[model samples]
Target: LFRWDGVRDVHIWLWETGIDFSSVIASFNCGTNTFAKNHLFRRLRWLGHRAASHLATLGYLAIWHGYHLGYFVLFLFEFGCVVAQEQLYALIDRTPGWAEFNAKPIVRPFVWLFGRLTINYAMGSTFMTMGLLKTKYWIGVSVRSINMFTILGCNSTIKSAFYVLT
Candidate 1:
């Protein structure tokens, strides 16, 4: 729900006011948005996919944080989550009646539950990556935690894409 409209409203308010402490604080608050809008997106516009630009932006953010392997791993996992969410939304939008079905009172709760579970799972892995720091340790932990269900869940999109291609 990070809508551009809220950001636009803040930008307009800032523009209408003179430079001040509040404006400076607001600018600092919007640093990520500013960087994405002004730098990464502009430079990667020719990539023709917002996801590519997003991946690049995440990589830049990871680099900005530090040169640690954990930082790169964490950001790459975040990029994957973003792509998965985007693909899920796009798929839902493209399928006739799917959005309506999801919106049904009876179905909505289950959908919300599933989404929450997925997000929690991703967050657990992310926190582990952040805590472990080293690539080998995190990789081992992740590998040990992986299950058949998770593997299938991750590959479902790839399978669907392959099916479409064929």
Candidate 2:
């Protein structure tokens, strides 16, 4: 699971090596103007779109490649957790007395274990890389709103504050 230790590890690595190996959960959109400042990169961004679409199509064929893999893995993880909960309740035989809690020992910590495994590095990389590769798709008001919502959803108001403060 992505507990404090895992986050600490990432921070340590970043501090020691000036490297950021953040996956999707730790990544967010940088504004387009910042990206487009690079002249050659701006032109090449168009080429990236055509290439990404073709690749996305190929990926679509390959078990829809990375996306489906992550999706199904997550599905199984959640399903197994539900089954475990069912068994936990059955084993408990009855609810608690204090508040009559009709459940078993909560394994909430383990919840995010499979979550992290299914949310593997490759899948996250593909997601962000695809987003980056499709600049046109992630630009303008519609995309900007979506990108902003994504960050806000992640509860990362800190980065947005950085944007505003700077």
Off by over 4 Å in 1: 1-34, 146-150, 156-166
For TM-score, the strongest prediction is 1
Candidate 1 local distance difference test against the native:
0.63
lDDT of 2 by residue, 1-166 (tens): 6556444323343233321223322232223223323433345556456333323333333343345343333323223333333344455565445223322246533444444553442134334434443444323533454355455552233233223223
The parts of candidate 2 lying over 4 Å away from their true place are 1-67, 94-166
TM-score of 2: 0.21
lDDT of model 1, residue 41 = 68
TM-scores for every predicted model: 0.65, 0.21
RMSD of each: 10.4, 19.0
lDDT of each: 0.63, 0.36
Minimal lDDT window, size 10, model 1: 16-25
